[model samples]
Target: MASDSYDFIIVGGGTAGLAVAARLSEDPSQRVLVLEAGHDAHSDPRIKTPASWLSLLGTDVDWNFRSEPQPLLDDRVISLNQGKVLGGSSATNAQVFVPPATAVVDHWENTLGNASWNWETLRPYFAKAYTSPPVDGTMAETLGIDGWTETSTTHGPVRTAFPGDQSHPIRKIWADTFRATGHYMAKDPFVGSTVGSFTALASVDPATGERSHSAAAYYYPIKTRENLHVITNATVEKVSLNRHGLNHVTAKATGVLYHCGDEIKEVTCEKEVILAAGALQSPKILELSGIGNADLLRQHEIDPIIDLPGVGENLYDHIMCSISFAAVDELETLDAIFRQEPDALEDAAKRYAKDGSGPFSSMGVYSYAYLPVLKHASPEGRQKLIELLEEARPTKGDTPEHARAQAYYEIAKASLLDPKQPSCAYLAFIAQFVGAFESNTKSFTISAMHSQPLSRGSVHIQSKSVATAPKLDPKYLSNPLDLEIFAANLLQIETIIRTSPLSTLIKQPIVHRDPASNLTDLDSAKNWIRKNGDSMWHYGGSCAMLAREMNGVVDEKLKVYGVENLRVVDASAIPIISTANIQATVYAFAERAADLIKESHGLKAAGA
Candidate 1:
């Protein structure tokens, strides 16, 4: 028989939840209960193997959530695949552990109303979340790793190291191409403000070459602890709160009403009810608990607990579009393996069966860059960007909405124009990665992503059911500025394709993987981007941490406003998107959030 109560109840055991649970349970005096919608999946091989991450999509471990038809992208309903299993999206995402720009983190404190959330304050947490492996001398010089003054940090739970065949030419070619273009990073990417091209580390551990994620790093090590109780396949329907109407004392969240096994169950908590159910679902859970907009709650007959209008607003994601070019005939790419050629599969399997080292150990996406579009753009393109910047300038007024709009626009505009700031993140993959289908031609791709977007969208409950996913509308490229940003990036990518070292690797008279991506002019590129652009699954900002006057749902401490002992600890609380892959930021944020929770309850702080 399970206990009826615990010191803390975490709803949705994902990336952030498990990290908090592990930290809290360390005290041994407090009982921590985690209610996970998905089952424990540490034993799943698809998740364990580094390169087999792509096979896990649409499986039981994936939420497989799709967005509402986006009108801007030819009415395409883009797939937003989130992890359903323990460790959450960290287990399923591409194993890139890149950090965001320091300036962007500072914006959370300086511009946005989040106190103590600046770069200097949160910088240490990034080092605390993941450890960088020791890089060899020769590989170091080739990767510009020699330029790093010192190793950023030595130790942390989420293990990270460079994976794949270390001798792979793509690594050298990528670094040299950026060096030739004079965009190689000036400083260690993790030390301070990150800019320029880098050979980013993967989440795969050096010891076994398996994916090192939140579950494997945090949960598995502490699973045997008596104070921690984790219940799998437990879907929390709503947070049980003492609703005394909107104007009365804040409703106190006491527990969660969940579905487990064959019966509906109730689990009470004495301290706090934390929501770590990602960006899309956390807002849905809050709305389901009647802590959202009163009018929206009333439509589903859910009596309002708090009138927070920001529960499902400010939703945004990294919009990405790729342009792939065929590699030279002599170049060895992932084409044979991706195509499932019989001999190739047999050879790879034999190698993997021997020592867990083979094609199954790498994703071949180690090369990456963060570039400002204008710096690489043509002279005419540069003038067009200046004009666009003026046209898209946001006006701030008295309303909180206006304040948020202006703040985000100014930050984005500065990033877009400033040569020191990264406007787009480019991934160079050793495969034909333009579209879904396997290609007969051997090719490589450079995928460009709009890191910080000006456009905002929403994720709201269609009904009061927790089983149903919220209606997600990212409103991709709805803002004309986003379209122009994509166009500018496309022009830059064209220039990169013609540049020296990278250009030398490609086949003569380049062949594009997708016909639509064969760029001719600005108009054609814009049209192609609209047809092809999609989310990178780095969604956040629905339940943002800002001043309540700015329509923020959570306070700086991650506590829900007007709600007692209730908090949201997930990507949803991030006021805006980061500059690169957000896994590192999420881990660091979770680490800091754990300490904040401990401080609130007079518990032993975990490495704060």
Candidate 2:
């Protein structure tokens, strides 16, 4: 049985939850409790080994939630994978540690009307969240990693390192190919603007070659602290709130009701209850607590506490589709080592066990390119995209909640179409074929990911039961503009494959489409996307942080509107998805949120 009370009870012991818990527990007087739905994965080999990430996809460590059949994709149900372990998706995701573009952060500040949320104010937290190793001789100085260490009282918990010296020969070829095709080579992608092609860093320690996630970096370091308590395998049912007399509009969360093993329990918090569950589950928790649409709550036989309809409305995620090619016999992919050669695999494992430097230590993705639509789209293609954006407006019957989502889509479309904006399309090259590794063939994949999507979806509780999964409708490629952008980006990827250095090593296309067939026709490319596209697993915006008039679930400070002592500090509060991977941004957001909470409670802030 866990303790009956604490100062702060954080629901969901994932990436954001652990970061907030670590910071809040810095003051020994504050009693902090974190409830995790999954067990502690400290010794799990599948999670510790970077190359073993794919094996954990359908296992118990994964939430393995499936999206509702997407209408745009011939009603195919796409898999939505999220980490259920202590570190959340950070423990399960590819260890790419890239930050968002400056423009994306600027959008959160200007569009959300929060002057303090810009990149400049949040820049310090990015430095505070991770301790980065030098990429090259001068990189530590250029990125100010040394400066951050010298100035700050406490060094960051998470460790960031390069992909090691043994990068595959194909990596350089891909980088050179992008430069030859007229894309600027990014000097360092971590310095705010990620506009060009560059080598990506991962969240791994170079010395030990083990995965560096929130659990290993943040929670475990302070687990023995008397004020910090963590409950594993506990599922939070609902947040228990106390309402003011006769005023349903005002309420304060006092405790949480959850189930641990065979017993149901209740834990009270004297100060606050923070919801750090990811996008899908966070909104479902709110709806279960009667804080969503009044009609939806009444339908579930739960009394409405707040009539905020934006609780689960504005859903956004990156959509990705891959174009795979068979690799030449001279080139060795990760798949070839495991499938063909047994003794070599044993030797590699021995090497990793002895020194932690081998194929098993890396994620196999070395270089990536971010391209704006203007870089690839023709004049006619650009005009077509504008027309598509203009036609994609809110319907007259859309509710206030949905209208707010439509307004955000307009802003996103404008940013994507703006030539000056950093990028809307991401092209990533993996050294191995992702889904078809079981086949007895050596292959590599080029995944074209659309960063800025206009389509919106929702995740709502179908019943008043936390045991049941929520209905998730990502509505991928629902907007014609998304398909249009994907088609243009696919052409750009093919151009890179056809360019000099990479083309010499390339073979025929394996899965997506015939390499010989010309995809110049827009409709043919769009059809191909509908059949092959899926989510990139970067989900957010179900509980966005915007003004109440914009149908926001939480305010700028991450406090849930109309409710006191209740806040959501996770990816769910992100209004717009960032241009790069979201884990770094999530960490930064948690770091800043901890400061805000400390200020409100009159507690001394961490790193003050």
Question: Which candidate's lDDT is highest?
Answer: 1
Give per-residue CA lDDT, model 2, range 1-608, as digits (tens). Answer: 24799999999898899999999999888999999999999889889887778888979999999999998887899999999999999999988887777777877777666557888888788889988764553554332232221222224888877654444665566666666766644455455664666656688877788899999999988889888999989999999988874656789999999998889999999999999999989999999998998999999998898888899988989888777666666666676555646876787789789888888888777666677765436687677767777777656545665657566666667676776565454544545544445455666667777887878788999999898999999988777667877777776666667777777666654233345324566676677678777888888999998888888899888999988899999999988887867898899999999989998898885455
Instruction: Determine which window of 10 residues in candidate 2 has minimal summed lDDT.
Output: 143-152
Residue 455: error of model 2 in Å?
0.8
lDDT tens per residue, model 1, 1-608: 26989999998788888888888898978899998889888988889887778888889999999999999899999999999998899889889888898889988998886999998998888887887887778787665465556458648888887777777777777777887878877566888756678778888887788899998998998799898999999898999999665567588999999998779999899999999999989999999998899999999999997889989999989988888888887766777787788987788777766776778777778778888875446677667778898898877489878877888887887676667888889988887877546546678888889887888999999998777788999998877898877777776787888788888879889777777888877798889877888889999999999888889999999999999889988999999898978998888898899889999999984343
Query: TM-score for each prediction?
Result: 0.96, 0.92
lDDT of each: 0.85, 0.78
lDDT of 2 at 541: 91
| Model 2: residues with Cα > 4 Å off, grouped in runs | 136-155, 164-167, 337-341, 375-381, 395-399, 422-427, 432-441, 508-518, 605-608
**Model 1 lDDT-worst window of ten:** 142-151
* Candidate 1, superposed: residue stretches over 4 Å from native: 142-144, 244-249, 375-383, 395-397, 435-440, 605-608
